[model samples]
Target: MPKPNEPILVALVLAAGSSRRFGSDKRLFAYNGTPLLQRSLVIPIQLGLATTVVLKPTDELFLPSLLGCYLHHPLLKVVYADDALLGMGHSLSAGIRSILQSSKSVEGALVFLADMPSLEVKTVRDIIRRFDSNKIVVPTYMATNGSLKAGHPVLFSRPWLKQLQKLSGDNGAKELLKKNPENIINVALDDKGIFLDIDHPAEVPGAKT
Candidate 1:
């Protein structure tokens, strides 16, 4: 729970992409017997953070799966991105707009990818715990190639929303991070789940069940 007088914070899950690279609707793809999008929502729901899910405006086939999560999770808000095909950035901007419009008290938004089901609940919690009004909190780790890499979910302070809402194309928040590298507070973690995302069937890990 947030401290008294603290502005509301939300987790914005970007799930609007058409999954052209995967050759299928990866958001609805089953991973470990659960839809991948739902898996991504697990940590957000468990932490009781207000979450907003962004999807394509024309998308209906995945409503059954999405609705199931929404019905059970009162903190979840669903919004549609009419220009989702424009790219992930547009989807992100749309989700942020919807969040601010609906929740006037929101001061920050933590961006989470819908295809990344391996992210642990603790990772999400720690990120939220470190969020500040002036600095962007990012979770990072070293990839298999030995280079350092930043991973989600990234928390952007309220001050970054104007630029965040102007984002477009597939870059997502990369441009913002690049232009404001000095404002970033990197939180290094031991979990490899931060680096795992399913973009193709071959990349899906074995189901626990």
Candidate 2:
């Protein structure tokens, strides 16, 4: 449960991608003894937030991992995207729509990617703490050249929920972000996990069995 009177924030995990670049079902890849899809949701569950995971309708392979990690968990929900093959935006829209249909008291949703298992719990909490009803919270990191780069997972406030539902195609929310530049707040972080994702087996640290 959330603190006494804190507004509820839903954590939406998008896992419906085809993973064409990863050469196999990337969500099933193991990370620290847990499948990456399940591992990526650890912080959200730990935070006591209402969580939903978006998966492709035909993705039966992810079930074992998802059930092993969050089966019957009160705060966790699983949703499937029928149009997932169309793009990330469709999956995102499906996740958000599921939350909206299931919960009426949610203040917003913290969108996460299933392959990004390296994000720390602290980073997730910090972003949630900074989220408000009017602004979007995005994480950023410093690059090798001293330049800053944006990263995930991003928190979308309630006001944008409808617009988020309309998102489709491969661009996801990039166009929405560009159109609402004034409403976005970038939180700088010292962690590089925000930018690191396990796209291939070779890219996963300690992948050796």
Candidate 3:
């Protein structure tokens, strides 16, 4: 693990996905007065992450209106991905590319999504402490009385950048995690925050802080 004082150059937030299935923009969905995306970012921002958010404006130039959605977070850098309709993988690449363009010294990239507001900060810190610049630490959540569930907020080491760039379409790291589950250390976390994501309109209300 890098020393606590060592600076981490970037954290990529993939938020450009079109919410066609959900019938509305999920990221903009509000919960407890905060946008879903805003709640999802609380953990990474505290880790000193220079977060790069990938967003695509609608064809009618909706960026101006949506800019209001991201207002007040001066640290948030919004990069418009004109081709966001392509897929989540493209958005992932776009966020990473924006970070690289800004600073090449980024030791690693912690990829989190715009819907997972439940991810615990301490769990995130635990993952960072284990990021030795070679391995990926992904969280696994076990329900107190139910089955286990796994999800994103995965930490990818620096060496995987080229392969990450090759990602296309919506298959964002799921397949890779399967191939090297051994290389991918699973940090056990009981927090449902590890498993909760606002996939539907109603699910939005139940999402954790």
In model 3, residue pairs whose N, Cα or C atoms come closer than 3 Å (at least 3 residues apart or on different chains), thus clashing, are 118-193
Tens-digit lDDT track of model 1 for 1-209: 56787646888999998888888778777888888888888887777788898988776655876656564568888888888998999999999888777866778999999988788888877887887898899999877887778898999988887678888999999988988889999998877788788878778877422
Q: Note the clash tally of each candidate.
A: 0, 0, 1
Q: Which ten residues in a row have the lowest lDDT in candidate 2?
A: 60-69
Candidate 2 per-residue lDDT over residues 97-139, each given as its tens digit: 9888887888889999889878888888788879888989999
Give the whole-model CA lDDT for all candidates, comma-separated. 0.83, 0.85, 0.72
* Among all candidates shown, the one with the greatest TM-score: 2
User: On residues 71-100, what C-alpha lDDT tens digit does candidate 3 reach at each position?
Assistant: 546557887776778888888777777777
* Candidate 2 pairs with clashing backbones: none
Would you list the rank order by lDDT, best first?
2, 1, 3
Per-residue error for 65 in candidate 2, Å, reads 3.8
Q: Of the candidates shown, which would achieve the greatest lDDT relative to the real structure? A: 2
